[model samples]
Target: MFTIEHDFDATVITLVDDPARHRQEDVTVNAFEDCVTLEQYDAQSDRVMRVTLSPAQVSDLAAALDLPEGVYKIGRKS
Candidate 1:
């Protein structure tokens, strides 16, 4: 399951794992103007872990989902 919310500075998207699936913590993605952040809880450390990505990296990641297994480079559209 997933949920989306629009905040003043960013758009927040939360991804919830299904009960039938493997037990995993939820992931929160925050999309900002300059960058995007992905966060998830770590049970071992008892803290939240966050990873920041640039716009280019986010674009590449989105493109990767539908692509075949191979190296790829994403270029900007005209």
Candidate 2:
């Protein structure tokens, strides 16, 4: 399951793990104008861990998802 919300400065997306299966903590993604952040709770540390990605990195990651087992480059959109 998932939920999306539009905040004053960013869009927030929460991904929920299904209870029927061996579940994991929820992931929260925050998309800002200049960057994106992915966060997940760490029970062992008792804190939330976050990873930030720049616009270019986000673009590359998106392109990589649909790609095959080969090296590739993503051309920036003009």
**Separate clash counts for every candidate:** 0, 0
Clashing pairs in 2: none
- How high is each candidate's TM-score? 0.92, 0.91
Candidate 2 segments exceeding 4 Å error: none
Please give the lDDT score at residue 30 for candidate 2.
99
Across residues 1-78, which tens digit of lDDT does each residue of candidate 2 receive?
999999999999999998966789999999999999999999999999999999999998999999988998877777
Question: After superposing candidate 1, which stretches have Cα over 4 Å from the reference?
Answer: none
Best by TM-score: 1
**Distance from true location, Cα of 60 in model 1, Å:** 0.2
- Judged by whole-model lDDT over C-alpha atoms, candidate 1 comes out at 0.95
Cα RMSD of predicted structure 2: 1.5
Clashing pairs in 1: none
Global CA lDDT computed for model 2 = 0.95
Candidate 1 per-residue lDDT, tens place, 1-78, comes to 999999999999999998965779999999999999999999999999999999999999999999999999776876
